[model samples]
Structures are given as C-alpha cells and as structure tokens.
Target: MNKDQVKGRIEEAKGKMKEVAGKVSGDKKLEREGKIQNISGKVQAGIGDLKEDIKDAI
Candidate 1:
C-alpha cells in the first residue's frame, strides 16, 4: 500500500483502540478524538484509493 493507505490504516486501528478505551474508561474527550482520527483515516484511505485507481487507469 502507498503511504496514505498505510498511514490511514494505522490511524484507523489506533483510533478504534482509543475509542474502545475511552468507552471503557468513561472518557468522552478521548472518544471524540478517536472518532475524529477514524474519520481522518478514512479520508486518507479514500485519497490513496483514488490515487491507485488513477494509476491503473493511466
């Protein structure tokens, strides 16, 4: 995978962990941070996917 894809996946996984930890520990701020991270990861991954698609098309 490209850098964006790899980083996105890592971020997504980390966010998921944080989200679970927040829920377990009753930390709303952590949960929110996790959600934002997850969204950012998804966006990054989408960009990576688009790049790959364009490369293939070309």
Candidate 2:
C-alpha cells in the first residue's frame, strides 16, 4: 500500500483506541476528537486508493 494508505490505517487505529479510552473514561472531548481523526483517516486512505487506481490505469 502507499504511504497515505498505511498512515491512514495507523491513524484510524489510534483514533479507535482513543475513542474507546474516552468512552471508558467518560470524556466527551476525547471521543469527539477520536471520531474526527477516524473520519480523516478514512478520507486519506480513500485518496490513496484513488491514486493507486489511477496509477494502475495509466
């Protein structure tokens, strides 16, 4: 996978961890932050996927 894909996956994992931790600790702020991070990661990964697809097509 490309750098963006790899990094996005890592970031998504970290966000998941943060989200769970926040839930366990009753921290709304942390949970929200994690949610945002997770979405960002997904978007990044999608971009990477598109890039790969285009490269292959060419």
**RMSD per model, one decimal:** 0.6, 0.6
Would you estimate the TM-scores of all the predictions?
A: 0.95, 0.95
How do the residues 1-58 of candidate 2 rate in per-residue lDDT, one tens digit apiece? Answer: 7999998888898889889988999999999899889889998898899999999999
Tens digits of lDDT, candidate 1, 5-53: 8898889988888888899999999998998898899899889988989
Which window of ten consecutive residues has the lowest lDDT sum in model 1? 1-10
Q: Please give the TM-score that candidate 1 achieves against the real structure.
A: 0.95
In candidate 1 the C-alpha lDDT for residue 47 amounts to 93
Alpha-carbon lDDT, every model: 0.89, 0.90
At residue 1, candidate 2 shows an lDDT of 79
lDDT of 2 at 15: 88
Among all windows of 10 consecutive residues in model 2, the one with the lowest summed lDDT is 9-18
